[model samples]
Every structure is written in C-alpha cells, then in structure tokens.
Target: MEAYVTIVAVAPFFLRLLKLLTIVLTSALLALPVYAASSPEQTLGLIRHTFRSHRPPPPFVRYTLTRRQLTNEGFPDFIWTYTYHIWCRTSDNAALGRRVFRGGSYGSLEFLRPTFNAATDPGPPTADLFEPAPATKQATPAPIFDRLREIGGVEALGETDYQVLSAVTEGELIHVRLLPRREPERNRLRELFADRRTYELKKAVATDRLFTQFQSYPELYTLTLGAAGGYPVVTAIHGVVDDSTFDEAARYIDYTFTEISFPATMPDWYFEPSGYGAHAKEAPQ
Candidate 1:
C-alpha cells in the first residue's frame, strides 16, 4: 500500500516534465536560419540567382499598351493606347502600331495613325509632314527587365557599382534596398520586393536626380510585374519627373500592359517596317 501511494504522487510530475520537453523541441524545430536574418549578402545572392535562372518568354510577344499622364491635381492630362509587337530577342526594337491619342490638345477623334519600323532602322520615321529625313535622336522606351539589369550593373546585383543596403522578410515578400556606389550613377535609391516562395521580382522602385544649369531635377520610377503563362511580365510602370524648381508641377505617367501573349511563330517580316503594308506611317513628332 505504501509503494502504490508513492507511484501515484510521482505520476503528475513525470507527465509535466514530458510536456516541457515537447515544447522545447517544437520551438527549436520552428526556429529560422541564423544566416537568413543576419546576412545581407546571402539574400542578395539568392535574388541574383533567381534573376539569372528566370526563363525569358519566346522570341515573339504582342500586347496592348495604355499610357496615361496625370496632372498634379490627379486629373488625366494625356492618354495614349497602342498595340505593341516586340521581338523578345531584342526588346529595344518594338513597333507601336495602331495608336490612339486623346486629351491635352488632341480632340476626341484626333487619333495618330499606325506606324512601324524596320529592325535595322534606328527608329520610326517622323510623323510631322514638314520634318526632315532621318528622325532626330531620342530616348526610346525599354522593357523593365532590361532597364533593371542595366541599372544594377549587368546580371550581377552586388557588383562594385551597387551596394546592397539591407534585406528583410516582410510577410510573403523579401524586400531589398540598394544604393549606387558611384557618383555618376545618378540614382539616389533602388528598392526591390520579391516573392518569398519564388524569389521573382514583384515590384521595384528607383529614384534618380539629375543636375542641369545649376538646378536639380528628381525623377521616380516604379514597376510592377504579374505572372502570365508561367512567366513574370511587367504589368504596369509609373514615373514622375519633378519640375517644381521651374514653377512647373510634377509630370506623372502611368503605362499599363494588357493582353500579353507569346506566339509560337512570327513571320520574318513582322518586325520589318515594310511589312506593315498600308498601315505603316511616320512616328509622332
């Protein structure tokens, strides 16, 4: 009878000990990796890997683009819609065909005619009737990935020109902030947010400042991407060029892409200006 009483008294204590041991083991199992929280280089390496491993879409891609500019008071000042055909091998050579322009000085029915350019040509011809031959040199719009790769100093993200400031996990995304290491970079800051599971860039923001004539002008650019047909595609781009120093309000532009597609086959002449047939015309002046 005395031995039985001792056994009953110690049973509760043994059960409590077992519960405490289980709790400790469970906490250890759920702990995050030490390097993930403390090492910024590792995070950068992962991001670079993800970018390098990304498979670009097929050679041919076509989409519709809608661009709108908003005034300082948030009113639409200009609107443009166009069908874009691009050869993915070289995105710099794209055709903005069947364009429609509205707002600003353009009347409701003032639509710019369709235009196309040859792959070997520098750019489209002048839309103005009185303009000279061989259009003047102008900046051309580029794909988001191309722009990012250029700004980040080629395919490597942590090159000498770029400095990774910090990286941290926030909910379902990994946020990385970077800065330009050289004075000539003109970039003030760059931030990238990627999906935690896939490490694909979901959004990116960059700021740049340019000095001209003893004055400084700041510009901000943002890009957002969405997954389409198992590939990450740029969905929207917004930019603002601050002109407050000249007593002019900031100019805001928003460009959105829709109906993105990657066709299996594209004719050789599709990229040539002559292939546009009767629709081929000069670019807007």
Candidate 2:
C-alpha cells in the first residue's frame, strides 16, 4: 500500500515535465526560419526567393504613383500624383502617362514614349517614371527591376556583389549590414532590415559615393517596403544628396507609392506613342 502511494505521487510530476518539454520544442520549431540563416548567402537567398515568387504578371500592368519632395527640414515642398500605364515585351517596354502636380506651381502634363526596345535603343529601357535618370540622358519611365539591374550591374544577389558585415535580431526583425564589393555602384554601404518570420524586406538604407565636377558626396537613400497583393513592394523612397562642392544645403527628395495595381487588360493603342495623344482624354486621372 505504501509503494502504491509513492507511485501515484510521482506520476503527476512526470506528466508536468513532459508538458514543459513539448512547449519548448514547439516554440523552437516556430522560430526555425528566423534563426536558420547562419550566413549572408542564406539570408540573401531568402530575399531573392521572395522577389522571384512575387513578381508581377507580365505583358502589362497599370498603377497609380504619388511622389513628394521634401526640404532638408522635412517640410513638404512638392507633390505629384500620376497614373502609369505600361506595356512590355521580351525586349521592349513603353509607357504613357499624365501627371497632376500639387503643393507647388500646380499644373498637369501629359507625355508618351513610343518604345524602349533593347535591340535598337541606345539606352536602358524606360517604362516607369520613378526610375532615376541616367547621367548622360534625360529621365524616362522604366521597369524598377530593369533599372536596378542596370545600376547595380548585377542580375541577382551573389556573394561577390556584397560583403555582409553583420546580422542581428531586433525584436521581430533581422537587420543586416553589407558593403559593395565593386566601385562606382550606388550601393557603397547598405543596411537592410527584414521580417524575422517572413524574411521580407521591411526597410533599407544605402549610402552612395556620388561624384560631381569638383568633388564626391555621400548620398543616402532610404527605402521602406510594404505588402501589396501578397508581395513586398516599395512604398516609400527618400534620398538626401550631400553638397560637398557647393555651399547649398543638402537636397532631399521623397517618393511615395500611394497606389499600385495589376490591371487585367489594357487597350492596344494605349502602349503606342503615336496613339497616345488621341487617347489622352480616355486616360485615367
């Protein structure tokens, strides 16, 4: 009878120990992705996979974009809102748009580009306005990915392109620091923060060495990403350009993506420059 009593007393303690262990194992499994990345390559692969898997549909996509310019003191100076209608083929991209300017000398401007065919064009493809203009030529609309590739000179993330400095966890995000391996790239140093669970890029800051006629200045670019149509999309971009040669205060520009979408169908003539003038009245405001 005494041995039976001792057995009953120990049974509850054994059950409690098993329960505690189960809870710990479950928590560790849930956090596997956050801690799984031991090196920069693995972290980069996760980001690359997210981008490739969430790529927008091909042929054409239309969306609205809002851009704002801010002063050095963080006051808004200019705001422009516009609709982007773009069509793309394997080798070419074309766009037609109308922009309404506000918060400054308010006005509206309509513009169209016929083609940015890679086969015959001298410059990179122009299909989106948010793209930064190349130094030699004027600003034009181009696909974001294409512009990034042209500027970064890298089609995909590779160990040779960046040297990872460090990775750390801050709350629910993993922040990583990296430096460019090559010169003349806009991304001289970059700090990227991503979601711990999803591994999606949340924010990034890039420091670039931009040169003018007299000297070089460190231009800082800040980017913020958010979810759009189940994929991470750039929601805001701000840049501070240092003025080393001139005594002028630093130049600050802010670009915001207020609206974005992937339209199902766009008319045939919408993509043609010759036909754009005729269809200006029909374009979405």
Candidate 3:
C-alpha cells in the first residue's frame, strides 16, 4: 500500500484533471452569468439535460453557505428565521435555489428566503458601527452580539474539527478573501474553492438584478433559493453563459439534465397565530 501510494504521489500529474476541470468551469462561470432560470420546472429540466447528456460525466454537486439572516415574530417572540444561499454545479450548468422555513410554533413563510436575522438589531450594540471604541472598553464583544456584528466581523468556518476557511466582505454585497492561517502546500487550491463560492454568490445576485431590471433570460441559466427553513426565503439567480449574444453564451457551458434533493427545516413562525388576540387571553381585572 505504501509503495502504491508513493507511486501515485510521484506520478507526473495527480491533480491535472481536477485542475483542468476547475479551470474550465471557473472560466465558464466568470465569462458568463452563473446561470439563468425561467421557473422551477424549467430549471430542473435543464439540469437533467446537462448531466444526463453525453459530453462528460456529471460532476458531484457542491454547496456553499454564503449568508444567513433571521427575524423576530409575535408575542413571546419564540420564533427565529434563517436564510441560506447554497450553490451547486451540474455537468454543463450551475444549479441554484432558495428556500424559506419558519421556526417556533404557529409560524409561516413570510416571503422567499425566510428572514434569518432580524431586519435590524433590536438589542444594544457591543460597540458602535463606525466610530472607534473608547480606550477603556474591551476590544472584543460580549458572547452574543447582534447579527450585524457577526456579519461585519470576520467569520471562520470549520469542517468537522479543523478550520477550513474564513470569509469577510468589504461591501455588504461583495465577498472579500482573507489570508489563511494554515500554510498547507495545497493552500492555493483551497483558496480557489473559496473564491469560486464567493464568485457564484456574487454572480447569483447580479443575475437576479438583471432579471428584475432587463427582463431577459440567458440561454444557460439557473435560479435557486436561500431558505430560512423549507421555502425560498431568499432566491439567487445565475447565468452559466452570457456572452455578446445568446448563441455564443450557450457554446461553453450548456446543460440539459439535472436533479437535486435537500432537507428543509420547518420555519419557527409557521405554526404561530397572527394578530394581537389570535390566541386566548386572560381578562383584564
């Protein structure tokens, strides 16, 4: 086994194929929009075509949790929402969707991309947004800070036990890469993965903006949601190919087949009753 391992390691090129595919895919995504979609049915059909077609075997789907948000509910305020943007790829297409789910009892989907974090922080801030903190105050925040603080500050993600990646954004929209602490030989490769995820999310947002403004859908396109629980709490749009013309864009990355399955967590507010007196109330003395 050791000899075989050594032989494989010494092979002229071990990651050549993976590197090539990644380069090709990344270039394709960058050149065009992440993907374009007309509707859920239309989008799923395209995935089927892309993967089941003959050009190349379908690759495994990959997902990245770009951002999350939450919101408050009625009396007792037991509910909390969560929205997530998960990205994946098909043989010749990028597949994406959004889902919104509620938390707590008697909740319901308020809108697509369940309001994960409260629209605004209701609690007091550990520190001010822009101004510098007083010298006497501690630099770090308390155990629980508002969503803005969490989003504004650097966030480190982990895989199992080890820290895999970290991300920070300059503008609320654009994703910025931070230096990695680990200095593995394959550090660059890992960074590329992070970059790709960020690019996908960014392009998804751009595609949605175009759809709303231009009313034009690219040939190779997909749309997915970021869900708080089960529904499209937040939706993302992507166009795999969008060159000068539709035909040109279709050439590089075109897919006709795909399928995806994901678990949907029930939103906390779904079962919650609405109105001030929806539930039985004690009579005032």
Regions more than 4 Å wrong, model 3: 1-110, 113-210, 222-238, 241-285
Clashes of 2: 5
Candidate 1 off by > 4 Å: 1-38, 72-74, 79-92, 100-158, 183-189, 207-218, 245-250, 278-285
Query: Which candidate has the top score in TM-score?
Result: 2
lDDT of 2 by residue, 1-285 (tens): 999999999999999999999999999888767436667766755654554555533545444445445544555544322323223331234444555544433223233433211111111121221222333323334334542232356454345556778878789888878777665242343777888877777887765444445665566767777765565556666767666442333365455655555555667665566766676667555
Candidate 2's TM-score:
0.65
In TM-score terms, candidate 3 sits at: 0.17
Q: What TM-scores do the predictions have?
A: 0.57, 0.65, 0.17
**Model 2 alpha-carbon drift over 4 Å, by segment:** 1-16, 56-59, 71-93, 101-109, 112-158, 186-189, 207-218, 244-250
Q: How many backbone clashes does candidate 3 have?
A: 68
Candidate 3 local lDDT, 48-166, one digit each (tens): 22222222212322232222222222222123223323222222122232332445233222212111111221101011111111223222222222222123464212222113233
